[model samples]
Target: MSEMRLYDAAGNRLYLNAEERAAFLAAARRQSARDRTLCETLHYTGCRASELLEITPARVDLSGGTVTLRSLKKRKDAKGSPRIVYRAVPVPPEYLDTLNTAHGLREAAKSRKKANAPIWPIGRVRLWQIVKRIMIEAGIPDAPHRSPKGLRHGFGINATVNGIPLHMVQKWMGHAQLSTTAIYADAVGREEQDIAARMWG
Candidate 1:
């Protein structure tokens, strides 16, 4: 049997450029409201699709403008006991607005769902389908080398490039290992070098 990877194995390993990010968001906006919300949630939170689906209204602390992530990784104690990982991620202002709008729309639709209802009702299969469609609309090739995972990687790379702290990035990504977060540090260094070259030249 092949060894399993912690992260999903799909999409280009490269981070998205500015133009590509714009195209992705534009294409997402043209999609159904549900899809748009999903895209916004993913871009804002940098959480896995499964984690995004698990988000509830209550998980968002509007006053503090943060969203708490209940990490999906399973842990065991020395004696082999089960435990849960959890992290609190900041909510971008725009994302909070999108969530507010989505919540209002849901309420207006007269859905009596509980406040703790899943933010995204779509199943994982449907989520993948939606991602595929959006990628096509955004002019991405229909290949495993450029899928939704690329978007997630893009988010992390972008954050690091913009000088967000590595530890914070790890927390936002819910990564247990600092080494995992270090991968994007190289990208940030490259970005810095490019900026320096432009200034000198």
Candidate 2:
């Protein structure tokens, strides 16, 4: 059965630790620009793969230093129509520079028609392959968490560990409930230790 824990039902850790995340980023940077942006965007934003795929040039706000993503989970109203929700998450300036350089986002963003095009044109399965390949290249151990979802989980934990508010994490993650986002606050052992160390210091 599924649980509200970071680990899977089989007890596999579902999020990458700091060292693993850093390794994954190093490996990602060695790849081509397209793959690098895809990997880095996922790393920084912690958005789901499908949500990443939906992003167009217009979605990237270079000046504002944020990427707006369309949330995949459609909440229906009383009329049963799916509501489209969007969330904007901040990214680094260098990440924005690389994304603009790789995809010509600035020029594309100028036109409504051009801006609507997806940044990464590949499908979900192909996207999964790219991330998994990067994970292997990073030398992350073989486990249930060695996929894109792991990266997402890592973002949550990293934010929590670094002292971001849970409500803000929930907003950035586009979670429907604060309870869902609260799980990251229950980080284990080493992560807890890091937070404790800061307190003790």
Candidate 3:
């Protein structure tokens, strides 16, 4: 891969700001239970849309307060066999509660058949549309950073701004290289300013 950038060639931002992120979550709440949890999962975990869709009931560890996501971007191992890399990202306990109430997660996980199946089970095209609709509902203007990728990038930046260690963000984002996670530290905006403010205080 060349590199991961938070901007396109035209210099439009490829990540949502703090306010936009909050708006997206607010709009996500207006969606149906399944869709709301889907959107919230993307927001909280910083996982790719495909990774979010790939999550199964068994992977949601309520007791552990984490969600195990298969890192789709990391495709192969050194020997060229398919590498199924799993990362357990910690999520808010409240999100877990909502997920359980909405999907009966604890119940589904008890059965082997239901545990292995994907939670969302929707195609990429449909999921994309749902995300786009939520963006509009959030009143986020048209921009390069208006899709699920934006949400993932936003999570990275948000975590960095909130003083979460860089290494932790790297693991949460499933970045193979720590350098890739460093990109979020380069993000500038009000959030960064707030971090700087603490120093001046």
Candidate 4:
């Protein structure tokens, strides 16, 4: 028997590397601004699909540079009761602008109709379709976990490679356990090489 490999050299999951992520973002940019923002939000925030759908203008704190995500994963409290967890993830300045533009702040400033409106009004099915189309356009072919979750996993790998603290990543990603976020530590990157080199030096 041979050892089975689930993912590529990247890690356990099939996540987008930096180049693939860039390509995806570029392809998204070529689409409508709405699509661009939708893709960017998913990648930048590392949020789940359903959590992305819950984003409303009110939930967006532009001044704070954060997006509050409601984690859909059910967890138990001290009493063993189910509870929903919410987390505020920091948004890159450029991504924040993209979202603001997509939401039509100018119009909302006047009519206020779009103020409380959901950023992406489409349902989960439509959102998935849009993401799949973008993935194909970006030259990311079909594969297992090739949907939005891939993007989310990619964000985790990217963050880990960039030297962000694991606990912070856990908090930002709304993981119920730090262990879930720690798995990104296995992602192959310069961080691994640097740590290995220090031992020899």
Worst 10 residues of 3 by lDDT: 187-196
Which model scores highest in lDDT? 2
lDDT of 1 by residue, 38-117 (tens): 88777777788788778877677766788877888776768889878777888777767777786763453344455577
Supply every candidate's count of residue pairs whose N, Cα or C atoms clash at under 3 angstroms: 1, 0, 0, 0
**Would you estimate the TM-scores of all the predictions?**
0.79, 0.92, 0.92, 0.82
How far is 133's C-alpha from truth in model 3 (Å)? 0.4
Across 1-201, the per-residue lDDT of candidate 2 in tens digits comes to 235579877877899978789999999999999999999999999999999999999999999999999999877767988898899999999999999999999999789988999999999999999999999999999998899999999999999888899999999999988998988988746577865787799
Better of 1 and 4 by TM-score: 4
Model 3 misplaced regions, further than 4 Å: 75-81, 188-191, 194-201
Determine the C-alpha RMSD for candidate 2 after optimal superposition of all C-alphas: 2.8
Clashing pairs in 1: 12-145
Deviation of model 4 at 18, angstroms: 1.2
Q: Local distance difference test, per candidate?
A: 0.72, 0.92, 0.91, 0.80
The residue pairs that clash in candidate 2, if any, are none
Supply the global lDDT for candidate 1.
0.72
**Tens digit of per-residue lDDT, candidate 3, span 1-201:** 698999899988899988899999999998999889999999999999989889999999999999999898856788988887899999999999999999998899889999998999999888989999999999999999999999999999999988899999999999988999999988856457855786698
What TM-score does prediction 1 earn? 0.79
